[model samples]
Target: MRVLHLAPYPPARDGIGAYARVLAAALADRGHETAVVAARPHPSSPPEVLGALGDPGLPEKIARFRPDLVHVQFAVPAFGLRVPAVLRLLRELDAPVVATLHEITRDTALLRAPGRLLYRRLASRCAALIVHTRDARAAAGSAELIPHFCAPPPPSTTTSDALRARFSLGSAPVVLAFGFIHVDKGLDVLADALRHVDDAMLVVAGAVRARDPLFKPMELRDRRHEREVRAALTRHGLAHRVVFTGHVPEAEVAAWFATAAVAVLPYRKAAQSGVAHLALASRTPLVATAVGGLPDLFSASGSATEPREAGEPSRGLLAPPGDAAELAKAIRTVLDGGGHPLQGLAPGPEEVAARTEALYERVLAGAV
Candidate 1:
């Protein structure tokens, strides 16, 4: 089968783009021909990236590619949180589309009634809407649940001692918090939690989403929150406890996960997290908030816990979103547990790709 990935592919600096790159590579390895139509023009993108969104002649280019299916790595953040642009892509695409809704519960999380209507409109045009968790499938009303893809963890190149020395980290457990630097990610909550943990060091493995000359409202909000976090940390004399390694490369990202005693996702609001999947790939022990589809990951069913989120008490791996005290406790618990990595990584990348291919077959046959 031939497939075309429609997303912010690499050189574009989005996780879903990185996702598309990996999925396309896996599909190609599975003997399928694959290509990409990036979300924007990135001059340095690889050859398989044939065109970009908003190119007047992109439709012609996709027509020439003649893909059997088009997979859209749909996320509001990737579109700079613009609904109209997302709608335009859904309405205008001229091939069978299977959209991976990277975020679904955001509308519900914020109680934004209009966003729900927009989601419905987007779903109506697709052959199938794919979500990574059953919580998302439930919230989406109509969607297919696919396991998130995780490539095997790479071997750690540098020892923990070397990593600590390189980063000027003192003798303390490292708690990692990564992905886009944004307020909703609860960096403020994380900073406050650090006050309680007392001994661990935080390695913030990212920078703000992107640079904007005019400074859009969203950009301003993120920057303001980051400043507040920094100020609070300084006031508490915890400035030396945190290190911000802004926007690192893939190798460095691996290194951080390798050295981290625990990975914390203290999102105040979220749809799901790609970072969680990365931690799973790294087999890093995690402490995450109960929000969006995160609960589905802990549930053996990967299904709904519904009206209330599920918690992994057996593993002590979950905390209430935005609760600094609970987050601090969870981090301490992981550290006390000797940093034994979390177990289980079923349905790795190849399995996920095969499942995706099966979904494509269903869509092409009008069975989805």
Candidate 2:
């Protein structure tokens, strides 16, 4: 099968870009001819650029590529608000089309009404629609629920000792929060939560790129948000206890996970989190807010609870969204080995690729 993948390719600085890289490679490994049409070509990406998704010439490129199927990794911001134009182009393509909707933010109907209408139109045109969480299914309408896929962590010679030494971190338990810095990630909440804990250091990894063409104009980097996070830590006298390792290389991401006593996802809101999947791949214990698809990921039954037993690693802990005190307690539990570790939650890259290929076949045959 010849497949044309549409998404941001690395080093485009989008998590969906990283996902495309993995999926494209997996398809190639399975003897399918896979090509990527990235939003923009980054120097690090292995595929050819077909310009941004919103470009008028995209239909011409699709005609030239002549793929058997077109697979789009969809995020509303990645394509912007110009859905009608993009939808028209997709309809022009000769090949069957499939789209994986990355998020559908629940409960903001007033703000998202227009986009939702456009999205429904887009979904109606596709052969199949895919979503990562059950929560997103209603918005996607008739969508198949496929869990978010993650590649296994790479083996690293860099050990916890080396990582701690490099960061000059002492024996204190480290709570890690990584990924592109954004206000929605709730960095300020994490900072406040850290104040109530004792003998622990916080590491904020990743950087905020100056411009993200994948995002809408209004969603560009907010330096003011970064300043607010720093000010909060300084005001609470946690300046020395937190380390900001801005924009580390991709190779070091797993090492940061391995070095941490626990990985924290203090998101204010999310449809699902790729960072949370990365933590699971690293086999690192996680503490996350019970918002969106997070609770589903951890098999969380209900509200926060004390870890059932010690030394018996399980699938991490969950706190209610936006509760600093509850988040603090969850972090403390994990650091003390009272919380479960995340393992075997998501499928490996190969399994995901195989399932996806089957879906592609089904969609092409109109059997879905």
What are the per-residue Cα lDDT tens digits for candidate 1 across 148-266?
A: 87664455566767779978997788999989998889999999999999888999989888743433766778988889999999999999999987887765667888788888999
How close to the true structure is residue 131 of candidate 2, measured as C-alpha lDDT?
Answer: 86
lDDT values, one for every candidate: 0.78, 0.77
Writing each residue's lDDT as its tens digit, candidate 2 over 271-303 gives: 888889888776678999987888876644433
Question: In model 2, how large is the Cα lDDT of residue 190?
Answer: 90
C-alpha RMSD in Å of predicted model 2 compared with the true structure: 3.8
Model 2: lDDT to the true structure: 0.77
Which portions of model 1 miss their true places by more than 4 Å? 81-93, 107-111, 152-162, 211-215, 299-316, 338-343
